[model samples]
Target: MDERELRNCFGKFPTGVTIVSWFDGSVQKGITVNSFTSVSLDPPLALVSIHKEAKACTGMKDKAFTINILSDEQESIAWQFAGSKQEILEIDWDNKGISPKINGSVAWMECKPWREYDAGDHVLFVGEIQELHFEDLEALTFYQGKMGSAKQLVK
Candidate 1:
């Protein structure tokens, strides 16, 4: 299959949205990411995939990162980060201490790099969870190129 076909196939799988953040001097840089997952519960490890050509890819390679899991109310926050200009809104980042994170996200996982693997067009970054925080809220999800809500799973 071609690139478009491959991307479409991948899109079939819905995933949660996250903001992968890292510090660049006094500025904290991050981007919206959906290619993130838990790798091991025993070690509290997670992974995020970034495009090889993306600017954030290199920054993540050398520094610690944070995965801010968005809440359903954070759709605007997600859109801002994912937008072409990377326009972020005025958010309450005081809770983050040093790094920046969206206010009222469902959870935040602060991590340090464990390893990096080179995939075809993306680099898979494995991270060891150093810190984690959670709030009482529903998570946001993405499916087939659109934001979606999760319904109850009836047994």
Candidate 2:
């Protein structure tokens, strides 16, 4: 299949939105990513795939990063980090004394890089979860190039 077909097929699967934040001195850099997942429970490992062209990709090396899992109410926050805006001054953000985190997110996971692999169009960053937090809110989801909420799939 062509690249367009491949992307379309990939988009068929829905995924949660997350903001991966890292520190550049006092300044914080973050990017919205849907390509994130748990790798292992015993080691508490997770991974995020970032495009080679992303500016935030290079800044993450050897630095602590926080994955702020967006709630359904955080579509604007996701769009902000997704590069929809030239500036994200309106978003409520804090460093949480560890790493940058978006306020009011459903969950947050602070991690340190464990490994990085070159994956052609993207780099896969594996991280060891350092800290985590959760709130009682529904998560935001991305599917077919649009934002929405996850619907429970009861079997």
Candidate 3:
């Protein structure tokens, strides 16, 4: 199998969209990430995997980061961060937590750095969830190389 074939196969799995954000001393840095998940509720842990070359990865060295679960209406915000160059974050950022978080997201998890691992070209940044909040809004998701919205089907 080739790279595109692998990526296409990976795209088949639906993933929630999250903006992994952190502060690099003086400024905020972040990236659009679909690679985030809850690790363990016992310890209240979670993970957000970012590319090794992403600024947010290196900037997170000794700081805190936030996992902002994007809502369906925040598709434009996703595109803005995932764009080629780091577009200046023009959104209202809330500082009531460990790291800067976007306003109006479906949910937010403020985490302190827990651990990190090398996962191929990505750096898995695990965090201990220090604070969390959620709303009843729908979530943004990615699947089959497209962005979409998802609502809890069982609830």
Q: Write the per-residue lDDT of candidate 3 for residues 1-155, one digit (tens) a residue.
A: 59999999998788888988877665767789998989999899999888888767777876788999999888878888787453564677887667989989999999998999999999888899999989998899888778878553211
lDDT per model vs. reference: 0.80, 0.87, 0.84
lDDT of 1 by residue, 1-155 (tens): 69798878888787888988877876778888999989999799999999998888887876788899998777777777676553555755633544566668899988888899999989999988888899988888887677745542111
Worst 10 residues of 1 by lDDT: 146-155
How does each model score on TM-score? 0.86, 0.91, 0.89
For candidate 2, report its TM-score: 0.91
lDDT (0-100) at residue 110 of candidate 3?
A: 95
Candidate 1 vs candidate 3: the TM-score winner is 3
lDDT by residue (1-155, candidate 2, tens digit) is 59999999999888999999988999888999999999999899999999999888788877888988999988887888898874545767787766788889999889988899999989999989988989999999898888878774211
Spell out the clash pairs found in candidate 2: none
Model 1 TM-score is 0.86
Off by over 4 Å in 1: 85-88, 94-99, 151-155
Each prediction's number of clashing residue pairs: 0, 0, 0
Model 3 alpha-carbon drift over 4 Å, by segment: 84-89, 151-155
Model 2: how far residue 128 lies from native, Å: 0.6
Task: Provide the global lDDT of candidate 1 against the true structure.
Answer: 0.80
Which is the winner by TM-score between candidate 2 and candidate 3? 2
lDDT of 3 at 85: 52
TM-score-sorted candidate list, best first: 2, 3, 1
